[model samples]
Target chain A: MIQLTDVTKQYPTKSGPRTILKGINLTIRKGEHVGILGRNGAGKSTLVRVIGGAEPPTTGTVEREMSVSWPLAFTGGFHAKLTGIDNLRFICRIYGVDFHDRLDFVKDFSELGAYLYEPLGVYSSGMRARLAFAISMTIDFDCYLIDEVMAVGDDSFREKCKVELFEKRADKAMLIVSHSHRYLKGTCNRFLLFRDGTIQEYDDFDEVYEKYKELLAEPQTF
Target chain B: MASNSLNSSSEGSFRQSLVVQGRVLHALLIREMLTRYGRNNLGFLWLFLEPMLFTLAVTALWTATRTIHGSDLPITAFAITGYASMLMWRNMPGRCINAIKGNTPLMFHRQVRPLDVYTSRILLEFGGSSASFVLLVMAFWAFDAVALPEDALQVVVGWLTLGWFGAGLAIVLGAVSEKSDLVDKLWPPFSYLLFPFSGAAFIVDSLPDKAREILLYLPMLNCVEFIREGYFGTKMHAHYDMPYVIVFNLVLTLLALGMVRMHVVEADYE
Candidate 1:
């Protein structure tokens, strides 16, 4: 289980302190799949980072009773200078898993084949995304926090992810942050909509997505 | 209770966190080694050799110049001890500053805190310089260019004192560098300015009483003097106050950890 109590995140700018997450109170029970819908610059990523324990909140507390995986994202985790294999090894090392155990699975899942020997800097964006997703899957966690979930890879890769995440790991809890209504409707059992640095929860997908669409069409306000 | 979430209640037992941190540090060390000295000529050999080569070059240049310090201490040993100490303290901060910029992605992992990143660099710096110092001294002894230290354990303690001071300074400066770009820019010239007064160039005993008083204010200079005293023993009169360096180091450690806790979590890469 993961619990966030009155969490707030702020970033300093030339103008002033920008409060991104004003007060977020949330809880994810065992094996619950939660999806968050938000437009750009709405602090969706910040909330996910806080829950994933990658970034600390400026105020309040987040408690995790079960192990949480790192924020699985398209970018901003892998060291580019290291080879794909080396990055995999590094992740395994830090997480206290044997790299040799996950080596085969990542090799087969990423499908970069020989490219895995080369530096991540040389891989194309698609290859990098595949590698990132594949590597994250190898680590076992009670809950997974995914950032920009629907944006990475292509149709086939998405299919692979669906099978690997939903079908294979069906018992695990997942918190996915994305703007795609269709994907969220299919994958998530509950929904959270981001507006004005706060989260509004909804159990029905259609109701939340309708509000999300309204938010997208709403006028700009700071 | 108000506490940083990274070290908060839900992160499991303290022992478990230490185990995780040890694993993270080992991963970071290997990763740093690969990125810094890739698969090329001599590869990671450059870790120790780079410092060793630097000391050798400085020693040769100093020998050629023939610095006469009134006392009859071997110039080779003086240069080696001095240069080695300087490199340990100097390189740590140099490498630590802006360390977040290059390794920002790694921070996405919850275990990879800013202090951990700085620590990995510090360890590398310490390891490299110490290996260089020991290897050069042994090689020189083999060739009969220098004698071994009179008190090996004392020499180790003095070296450790200087390293501790350097590590503390590096952590403080490294954390501060994240707040302002000026620290990164200012540190190089500042370190250079400190070299002439760093006990590398002259003996504390040889200096005039007034000059010695002023130079002793430099903690690094005092440490260098201590190390030399350990090496030369009764032959050279070395003046240093160990308590002073320890107190200064304690303060630096507090500032460093406090600053890292406050600001380092906010670090992000563009």
Candidate 2:
């Protein structure tokens, strides 16, 4: 189980302290699939990072008993002059995986083909995304946290990701952050709408998503 | 209870996997050497040659001075041996400090520990500098220019001490550099100041009385003196204390390792 008790994060600014998350009391049980829906600048990414252990909460305790994987943001590792195959092997070595099995999986799933033996830095943004996604999905984790999931790669890659990860890895708990209601509704049964400085959970995603959209659509003169 | 998480079956296996990732660090070091020096015909040959050239220049200049501390030893053999060893002492620490910032991309890999990056650079610096020393010694022997050390084991011990000292310094410098950008400004002048006290061009015994008393206690001076003693077969003008260097480095290394654990984790903060 993962629990956040009375979490509050504040960042200092020229004006004063800007509060991000205030008194965020939450618990996620095993095998729960969750979608976190929030507009830009609503602390969605910060929540994901904190849960992933990439960052610590400023004023509250985050207790995690399960392994967590955060969505990959960048692809390049050291020795950019090396080929994609070489880089994969290097990463596998670091991660302590048997090179043959992981290598085959990455080669097949990433679809880099002849480009596999060429320098990875030369690969396009989509190719890099595919490679990062393929590697991250192959790692088994109890909790997978994703941010801006719909923005990467193409439509086919997205569908392929859903089939390979969400479908195949159903027993694992997941937290997906995205603005697309259609994708969230299809993939996630539960939703948390982040607004102002706290998260509000809703068993009915449609109801929460509608309210979230309505709130976002109406702009003020402030 | 805390230990249970660390001792999990998967965690044990995961920790074991880091050993494999350490090799990637070696590959990165090779890339660092090549990219910095350029892939010319000379390639890595310069790693050996640079120290040798410094040794040769220092030897010639000191030889012209006739006598050092009224000792009759050939200044060429004395300076060359000491100077070459000092390179190993000096370069490793400086390079290790910059290792993390240099390979920032590798930090994203869960398996690539921060120390692994520094360790790779340390290994490369030691290997290159050690190779240069050996090559220079062999060249001198091939031409019947100088005699080998009387106690080969003592020379090896000296080299190891110098190496650890360098690693310790590098670790602390690396940690401090992350917090403050002052390392970039301080590094050049810091290295320049190290030159006079390094026991490179002259033996600790040869420094005029007052300077000699202070220089003998400096960390690398013992190793330099020890290496020179091995080559020259006698303790020329002063005796060296080895225990001081070892103890000081061990404490410094432990402190550095702690600081690294704390500061390095901050880099990944979201």
Candidate 3:
């Protein structure tokens, strides 16, 4: 189980301090698949980052009772000059895996072909995404923090991933952040809507979708 | 064996994890070297090329000045011994200063401790510098430029001591820079101040009494004194203190380890 009690996050802007999360109280249980929805600048990324332990809240506690795989496709953490094989070995070493034992498994799972021997700087977006996803899946964590960075991969891989990540790992909790309603509805069991520094949970995706449509259906008021 | 280890059936699996982490640190060192040298056709030759070129330039300047300065050795030998040792000490702390912040991605792996990054960098610098030292000795022999150390063990002890001293200081600077901007601003001045004590261009025996007394307290001077004793076959004139170097380095290493432990490992990226 993961719990956040009275979590708050504030950022200093040119104008003044802007509060992003104000006293957010949340608890996510095992076997839960949650989708976070908010318009641009609604703190969706900030919320996930806080949960992943990438950022700490200003005034609250986050208690994670299970291990988490954070943002499976984040490229910011990799050394660009390293070959994919070396990167894989480094990641394996860091994760305490016997890299030589899993070498073939990682190679086959990534499907990176000859390009795996080349420096990662030479990889295309899709290839890098494949590598990231393959590496994260190698370790079975109790929860996964998913961002939409994997959307660039081809359709077949996406379908395979959806099945493996959601259906196969149904026991693992998921917090998915994406702008696509169809994608969220298909993968998630519940919706979390953020507005004005507060989060409102919707037990049903349909109810949140209806409200989202109604909110967007009106003409511009600004 | 695989089944026992894989299933955590072996009672020693916990200890084995530390070995795995060390190997991980070694791999990171290899990655750093490959990225630094760039896979040009020259390949690993640049490792030797860099220190050799610097040693030669300094040798030329010393010869032109014709200053033997109380040492019974030739100018090339003095330059080779002093400059090579200084090169190792000089480069390590500078490299370690940014080591942690540079590998931000490695921190994401929960198994990769921040201390591992520092260790990998120190080892890599040590390897490169040690190689250069051996290569210089070989080059001197091939050219008949210098004779073997009178007592080779002292030479080895001195170099090892100097390496640890550099590593200790590297740890301190690495930790200090992570917390404040002062290191970046003060580093050049610090380097300049250290230049006199580093024994780069001059032998320690050349200094006056007051100067020699002050210079003897510097960690690098003990190293140079010990190394020069091996080269010149005299008790190194700068007082050659061993206990001081060891104690100072141990304190610095502990301080660095403490600073590293205090870091959050995340959320401080900016």
Candidate 4:
């Protein structure tokens, strides 16, 4: 279970402080897949980051009773100067898992045979994403947090991700933030629409999709 | 009944948090080593070699110049003891200042705190410099270039005090630099200014009475004096107050930890 109480996030800008989230209260129980949709600058990514414990809220509390993984396949967590295998070893050590045991699995899953030994700085975007996906999959978490970078690599790799995350871990809870409504419709059980620093939940995908379309069609007030 | 269960569970999680922090620190230490000193061309050997080279250059300069200040002691011994302690204390804050910004991605992990980042850098600085100091002393003694330290216990204690002081200062600087750009601009000039008063070049006993009294207020100066006393023994007089250094370190450590806690709370992730 993950719970957030009165969560607020603000960033200092050149023109005073910009408020991103305003007193958000949320709870996600086990086995619930949540999809978050938002237009540009609507704080979808910030909300997920706060939920994943990557960033602390400006004012509020987050209580996590389950292990929460970092945003899946996000390259920000890997050190570019280190090799893919070295980055894997570091993450494994911190997570208190045996790196040696998971090495073969990550190598086979990532499919970057000899590239794992090379520095991550040298790896192409696709290779880095593949390594990130494989490592996140190797580590078992009660809940996974994913940002918009889900559809990485070619068609085959996308299929692999869908099978690994959706088919294999069907029971695990997931919170995904994405602009692709079709992908969310296929994956998520519930929907959250972020607008004006607040969230509105929709139990039905078609209903939320209509509302989302209306929201997009509306002219910008500011 | 629900509250009771919540309290018990929270207590259990607290203990688990400590274990997670330990594991994260261990991982960070290994990552620091690998990234800092890669597997090619002398690798980890450079950790000790860097400091040894600095000390050797300074010692050679002092010997060649014959710049003795009313003291009959060997310039090599004087230079090594002073410069090694200087590097141990001075390099730490510089290394720590922008550490978090460089490893921003690592902060994504729930278990990796800002404190862990500073701790790993501090450990590397302290460990590398401390090892180099010990090795240099041994080498010099073997060559009959310097005498064995008079009191090994005092030397160890003094060295540890210096490390503790450096670690605490580094933590504070690391957190402060994260908040403001001014610290980045000011620290270099400030550190250079501090070098002279750090007691790296002269003994406290050689200073004028009024100058000695003021230098005593600087904890780093006391740390250097304590170390020199251990090295030179009764051959030279060293002025340092142990209790003052201890209290200074304790206060600075508490302040550093408090600053780090604030940084973690206020940290804005990208």
The top-ranked prediction according to DockQ is: 4
What residue runs in model 2 are displaced by over 4 Å at the alpha carbon?
A: A4-26, A39-42, A56-63, A76-79, A195-198, A207-222, B1-44, B56-80, B98-112, B143-146, B265-270
| Ranked candidates, highest TM-score first | 4, 1, 3, 2
**What DockQ results for candidate 4?**
0.49
Give the interface RMSD of candidate 3: 6.5
Number of the candidate with higher TM-score, 1 or 4: 4
Candidate 3, pairs of clashing residues? A77-B105
What lDDT does candidate 2 reach at residue B164? 88
- Local distance difference test, each candidate: 0.83, 0.71, 0.74, 0.83
**CA-RMSD of model 2:** 4.6
What would the DockQ be for model 1? 0.39
lDDT of 3: 0.74
Regions of candidate 3 where Cα sits further than 4 Å from its true position: A2-27, A39-65, A98-111, A194-200, A207-222, B1-17, B38-43, B68-70, B264-270
> Cα lDDT for residue B100, model 3?
70
CAPRI level of candidate 4: medium
RMSD of each: 3.5, 4.6, 4.8, 3.3
Docking class of 1: acceptable
Residue B139 local lDDT, model 2: 82
Candidate 4 structure quality by residue, lDDT tens digits, A1-222: 888888999988888999999989889988899999878888898898888766789988778777777889988988888999999998888878888999998988899999999999999999999999999987888788988756688888888988999999989999998888889999999899988889999999999988888989988652
Q: Could you arrange the candidates by DockQ from highest to lowest?
A: 4, 1, 3, 2
Q: What is the interface root-mean-square deviation of candidate 2?
A: 5.6
Candidate 4, residues B208-265: lDDT per residue as tens digits? 9999999899888898889888878888888999899899899999999888877653
TM-score of each: 0.91, 0.80, 0.83, 0.93
